[model samples]
Target: MNTRQIIIIALLIIALVIPGSSLLGEKEYPKFLEEPWDHSPITVYIDEQNTPPHYSPSYQPTVIRALQYWEKGGNGKLSYNPVFELANTSDADIYIMWVENMEEVTGAEEGVAGFCRPMIANGRYVHADIVLEVGDYKGYSWQQYGDDNMEQLVTHELGHALGLGHSNDIRDIMYPTYEQRENLNPLLVQTTYPLIVISILIAIGISGYLGVGWLRYHKRRKRLENELLKEMK
Candidate 1:
C-alpha cells in the first residue's frame, strides 16, 4: 500500500526465494569410496627403518597413539578400525613413514606436515601410505609436539587414506592444515545440529501461524453465513 510496505514485501519475497541452508558455510567431506569400510580392521605398519633417526623408536609410540586416537575419536563414523601390527612393509595394508622433507610427497618447500597416498582398485581403496614431515617443526622437541600435535597430524592423514578429502572447515580433522589443537572444534563435529534445530523451530512457528489464519478465516465465513440467513428471514 505504501513505499515502506512495498519495500518490506519485496524483502520478504527475496528471503523466500533464497535457500535457507545456503546461509551456513557448510561443505561436503570429499569421500574416497562409495561405501566406507564396514568396521573392518585396517592393518597399519609403522616403518621403523625408513623413519628419520631423530624420530625413531620414540616416534613409534606416537604413531601407535595416533592410530588409537582415530579408532576411539572417530565416533564410529570412520567405519574402519586401525589395527597396528609388526608386519613387514609388503604385508601391511597401511604404512606410516616419517620424512625429513615433504618436498617429494607435496610440492611445497616448507610447512608440509604430512601426505597420504591411497591405492585404489575396482573403485575401492586397497592400501595407503602416509608420510609425516617431522622437519616441518624443526626446533620444537618431539615431546612438545609429539604428544597431541603428532596424533592430530596422523589422524588427518589417516582420514585422507580412509577416502576423505581435505575439508574447508579448519575445525575438521580432514582440514588441509594440521592444527596443533587437542581435539576438533564443536562446529565441525556437528555441523548440522544447530541448523536442524533452527529448521524445526521455524517449521513449528509456520504451522502455528497457518493454523491461526485458517481458524480466523473459518470464523469469519461462519459469521457471514449467519448474517445472510438473518437477512433472508
Candidate 2:
C-alpha cells in the first residue's frame, strides 16, 4: 500500500487497541466462597475501642449503615440487624476490629488494606473476624481510606463473613481491590460486558466495511486500466 494508506490503517488499529486494553480488567478469584449462612439476621460485634481513624460518636452509625448495605444487597438471601448489639458475648457471629497496621493482622502482611478470616467447624461457619487498617505508614497514604472507600470495604468484608466470595466485576462491592464507585454500597450492578459486546460488533462492522471498500476500489481501478489498454490496442 502507499504511505498514506498504510498510515491510515496503522492509526485505526492503534485506536482500536488502546481502548480494548483499558476495557480489559483483572479477574480476581474469591478465596472463601462457602455455603450461605444458615441463619437470618446474623449478629455482629464491633470493637468500639479500635474505631476508624478520627473517631467520632457519629462513626458507629456509619458503620452500622455499612452492615445494613449487605442486608439490602443480599436481596433476602442474608440479613443483619439494623441495630448492632453490644458485644457482651465473646462468640458473636462477626467481629470487626481496626488495627494500626497490616503486621498486626498478620506478622508479615504488608500492602493489604484489610482481610477476612472465617472460623469453620464441622464444615460450617461459626464466626469470622474482619480487620480494617487505619494506622499511619511512611510513604503510604493508605491511612486516608475514608468516606465511600472505608464503608464499601466494610460491606465487602461482611460479604466474606456471610460465606460469600469476591466478584470479578469491579462494579461489585465484593471486588477484591479497593475501587471507588460513583455510588457507595451499590445494591444493583451495572456491568461493562454489554458495552464490550457492542464495541466488538462495531469494530467488526467497521473492518468489514473498510475491506469491502478497498476491494471495490481496486476492482474499479483495474477496469479503468483494462479499458485504456483496449483503446491503445
Q: Which candidate is the best by lDDT?
A: 1
What residue runs in model 1 are displaced by over 4 Å at the alpha carbon? 1-27, 34-39, 73-86, 104-109, 137-145, 179-233
Local lDDT at 114 for model 2: 69
Root-mean-square deviation of every model: 17.1, 16.7
lDDT of candidate 2 over 1-233, digit per residue (tens):
57887677667667766665445332223323235355655678778765655444444565687876765554233323333344645578788887656565555344566667777666556788887765436584545555566676677777767655556666767777742221221111112333344345445545564676555555555665564444333
Error of 2 at 9 (Å): 40
lDDT of 1 by residue, 53-164 (tens): 4564666777776677666755233534555455666557788888765654456545567777767666565777887876554556332245567777888887766655
Q: What TM-score goes with each of the models?
A: 0.55, 0.53
Q: lDDT for model 2, on a 0 to 1 scale?
A: 0.56
Top TM-score model: 1
TM-score of 2: 0.53
